[model samples]
Target: MSPQPHEKRQTLAHRLLEVRLQGRAAVLKGHHNTNYVLRIGLPLAVVLGVMPFVRFKYRVPLKTVEVVPRIWRSEVDVLAVVCRHLREVPRGFAVQGDRSLHRYRRGIVLSEQNPHGPVDENMLREFAAFFVRTAKVPVKELPAPPRDWPVDGESAKFLHWLIEFTERRVHLPNRERFGDLFDQVGIPADAMAAFKERHLSLVSRRFVLLHTDVHRANVVVRRKGITVIDWELAIYGDPLHDLATHIVRMGYSPTERRQMVDLWERAMQAADLGPLTAGLHDDLDTYVDFEYAQSVYPDVMRAALGLPTEAGDEHFRVAAERVWSAMDRARGPLELKSVKDVDQIMEALRKWHSMDAVSAETTVV
Candidate 1:
């Protein structure tokens, strides 16, 4: 008698879990293929052929789950491996670590089954507060951000690098990429050039630890507290970039988004962190706009996956258009003077949202 294919896969999964978990006491609690609950475990060691980095250890009670439709189950499994590794390291935010974890041989297939729904406004605010608190911690004390230390006049440069890096096909084709929906909308090349030119310098501000992918799905609300997972994209960068990414991905309404921004401002102020000054806020708005503009790139996934290009293009076009219309309504004339004016920033946000609305309508029909 021999093990069947399903049994073999399960055996491999269990073996991988054991190797990854080392001697840690963990229970496989859920029926999902890649789900487990690990309570009170020491960090697993990563044994390289050469020197072994001291794995950061944390005893936090953790539950890990990864769900991928049949089409993307393989890719999801790879992602789950990375997630499991991160869970072993203490001080690991959602995005931080070596580039090896960033690479995957396959692309994700996103459908209604895999769609990330809009985050609730209240949850958005709470996560915003949590992110701000986590980000403000001095770098030396925790995991360093994924890039060079922040130098003045390099904010835009950093952002450009990130956008380019994210767009690169080597890591993941823009279309198959999870977050490249903005590139699909038909923004004129000139509009994109102007948008980038106007705000490339925004990246030069103070850098902080950022989750990089702070969307609702990455955050799991548990009875203990909000536990943010997935740090493959975590980096040391502009805090607002993190906020903009989360807000855009969450797909919140303009009014709800605005309220979340207000909550972010108040939380920062109350913490004596800093004012949400006008320039900074506008810069965040611009980041959101650029992200919206690039949303269409994800349409490329259709061709990559051997699906009908026209249908995929149409789907991406609609998504990009909606986000662009929202941006149009959310943004205003950029009056970014300093980094503390909350009102001016909110105006810009209003315009961005308006633009996103137009794009959204175009996407539908």
Candidate 2:
């Protein structure tokens, strides 16, 4: 038999308490993701990791690479592989664990989160230089690229992944809802096709191991400088994807986004990696489109859960506004036939609130 609901809460609370045992301050709920992160020191925090592969554990913690991979980790810990080679990490952390614990995995120690906001262009440029240089750091020999990513041309491989991910992963699971989302936004469902037609040539230009998940939240601001964290999503794809992900996820204003691209290009050029920044003139939008497009599902799911109730009208409005942004950006890829205004989208979210409680009721554009 399974544990009672309260029993489950107790278990989670117990785990959180264990996570906070070393903290100098309160254990704070992480800004995003399920992990409960604790402020261990002035510029230090440790993320209690959720298991990576298994999806439905009621958002419960699962086994994860809590240590610096170099200190201790499995072969698949590519993040650690990079940590082993790179120096400009968030801060140094060694693995800490004990035998008595049941569920408290060693935490992913990081410098404090990037003051919970976007980094400036100068910082972004510094990060770009550090990023590519780290990529250039010659490992004794780069291990075989991910199996999903064969040792093939970067452009073709990621294009294949993009379409496959959207169609199979995004469209398949939430077909009706995703289709409705597209219809509501007046976008073509064949957005993936558009991505290929437009951006394919650009990604083909360069091949470098990329810290694909570099965004503001993952970047921690320190007194000295910024430290990039969250290396798990790192992929060996077009370097532009890194820039695209950073632009979108950091919530960089349009001006800053453009500056980010320019700064990145200049940084790469200075490093003599000019070819790496190629195709930004036209192809960057393709990757940005893919980033926004792919995010529709996850964004909706988050909005559904976090939207406010009757007493929380203001919060709900904020959540609705965010959903509106996601839908608006993803309109084309989602293949909407009609554009739903923000008010309509807000109402839809209110209607969907009941469904949010049903953890397994998964479907969204």
Question: How does each model score on TM-score?
Answer: 0.51, 0.67
Cα lDDT of model 2 by residue, 1-365, tens digit: 99876445445545544554554332233333244334332211222243322111011123431211121222224444665566555222222221111122232222244434555666766677666776575543455554566344466566567666666665556654444543443345666666556544545656666676676555555566655654444556567777777777777777777787888888788888887776676678877777787776566656655654442677667776877787788766545554567777767666556544343345432
Model 1 lDDT tens row, 1-365: 99766455444434443555565543422122232233222222221111233332222222322111121113223344333433322232111111111111112212122355554666666676676665565554444333444452367776675555434532243223322222222223233344456655653465665666666545555444455654545555567777788778777788778877888877777777664333556787777865654443332222222222233444434443444444353343222122323333233333434454566679899
The global C-alpha lDDT for each of the candidates, from Candidate 1 onward, is 0.45, 0.55
lDDT of predicted model 2? 0.55
C-alpha lDDT (0 to 100) for residue 271 of candidate 2? 82
- Please give me the total number of clashing residue pairs in predicted model 1: 74
Candidate 1 RMSD computed on C-alpha atoms after optimal superposition onto the true structure: 14.1
Stretches of candidate 1 exceeding 4 Å from the true structure? 1-121, 142-153, 166-195, 275-278, 302-365
- Ten residues in sequence with the least summed lDDT for candidate 1: 96-105
Candidate 2 residues lying further than 4 Å off, grouped into runs, are 1-25, 31-76, 90-121, 139-143, 175-190, 197-200, 308-316, 331-338, 355-365
